[model samples]
Target: MAFREYKIGTRMFGIALGGSMMITLYMPSLTIYSVGVTETGLVKGLSYGHNSGFSYEDPFLQGKGKPLTVTIKKDPVTGADIDPVDAYVYVPGTPFPSAVRNPGILGTEVAALSADDGQVGVATSDEGAVFLVSRGDYEGETFPYIENASATRDWTAAAVLASAADTDKRHVGSGKTMFVREGCEVSYAAS
Candidate 1:
């Protein structure tokens, strides 16, 4: 009925790839939502965060009303944010799949959209794809798509993501920076 915003807990409860990514299984039917919403951010105690400091670590990308910066992962070994993967694309939502890491499951194929508004690229990783989402709380944001060399926070459509390298063009997804968690909101994953 509603296309909720995504957060760190939004990843499905199916299989987890490495630690940063998960193969979606039970989060059925994702194309696009006609309604708008806002997802809560991760809380850190109760200092009223974000000045050292963010309200919470929101990974989803957006550019509607609020402007968000993309989160980059370090090499762990290298400790640098150089040439980051940006984002990862899953199945039906992203038109291009070969450019990113394949979940190698039912997600390998894109589902046919009925009245498609077309899909844009988002992002993910292989180790722990902790998908986060919003149940009507994350305003001015949506999923993140990393295949574009940068996050999709600019709100560009699928066409802008393409280029000379077909691979780069096809690496589309819903993740630009961030899905579901728990408590009252996180439980929505199961529902």
Candidate 2:
């Protein structure tokens, strides 16, 4: 088996939590390949199995000897680059679940989305609990959903989401945000 690896170094600038901040992300992964890699950007590596893997977005298929660089823009609302509070990277040949989003289906829970359109959803066990999803790409950024303030509980879920209503639940895209309220049970899934 041929071992192909990719290393990505990224720098971000924007406003987060009402302050200017800069962040850097180091990402590396290995894959089994014969040749060729093209697309390059920050992606949530998904679709992992023995001898192969896939990303939510198309993986850069450029051949070896290429350097991948990415620049994260500022949040539209806050006008500052969001911080990647819970970014993660894989070691090339790791086993992971798919990051695709299916409506009303349960998926693996991750800290953040690695690629754009990485599917994510929320579930709640508590009654009257609601989650708000922000409409934006939240990959390489940190947007935590506060479960309880009095008890001081936090979840590494997505950020800046639309409110998930008791009657209607929806899936959010990668780099988005979510907030839970009213003691509702909330869980996230990715394809």
Candidate 3:
């Protein structure tokens, strides 16, 4: 007894069946979030008990155990990256917790950052945080949390988990397949 109204500009195109027009529509959304630093020249690895590494895991997609292919945006956003220093908090006034934990996405999340090029992966988890302050001197001093982090200083990205269907490949019978293709560029955070 309840009907949902489609928004204007909504693409409703599909095959005609049973003397009636059958239309299918898919709505996909992308989220970009940022890991901002409050102070300049702040030490990168303060939360993870280190001074030289950064890493995080998406809690939502832990069990899937699939790696996501991340690509940084060609043009970095302004104020997207920040320099690290030894401070009580990365964001001014927001004191660092005794321990920092990675808060992952709700539906699907990133598991880990790949060693090469820093692409994220998905995996299994009982209750771990999605993002985490990494360990080691290489990532801590060399890498920024966001893409082109050192240059841009800010890291923002779209959630890229391979577990999600990147493309639509549904077969509705009748020698025809129905699917919705989704595309997104890897950024630092969800907006």
Output the worst ten-in-a-row residue range by lDDT, candidate 1.
111-120
Model 2, span 44-129: residue lDDT tens: 12111111212333244111111111121323234455543222212222222222122211211122321223323332222111
Over the stretch 1-191, how does candidate 1's per-residue lDDT look in tens digits?
Answer: 78766654456433245233322422322322222111122111001111121122233322111111222343323354545332221212322222123222112122111001112124322211112121111234232221222232332322122211233322111122123111212111122
- Model 3 lDDT tens row, 68-95: 2222222233423334311111221212
Clashes of each: 58, 42, 40
Top-scoring candidate (lDDT): 3
lDDT of each: 0.23, 0.22, 0.23
Tell me which of candidates 1 and 3 scores higher on lDDT.
3
lDDT of 3 at 171: 12
For model 3, the run of ten residues with the poorest summed lDDT: 171-180
RMSD of 2: 21.6
Best by TM-score: 2
**Model 2 worst lDDT run, 10 consecutive residues:** 61-70
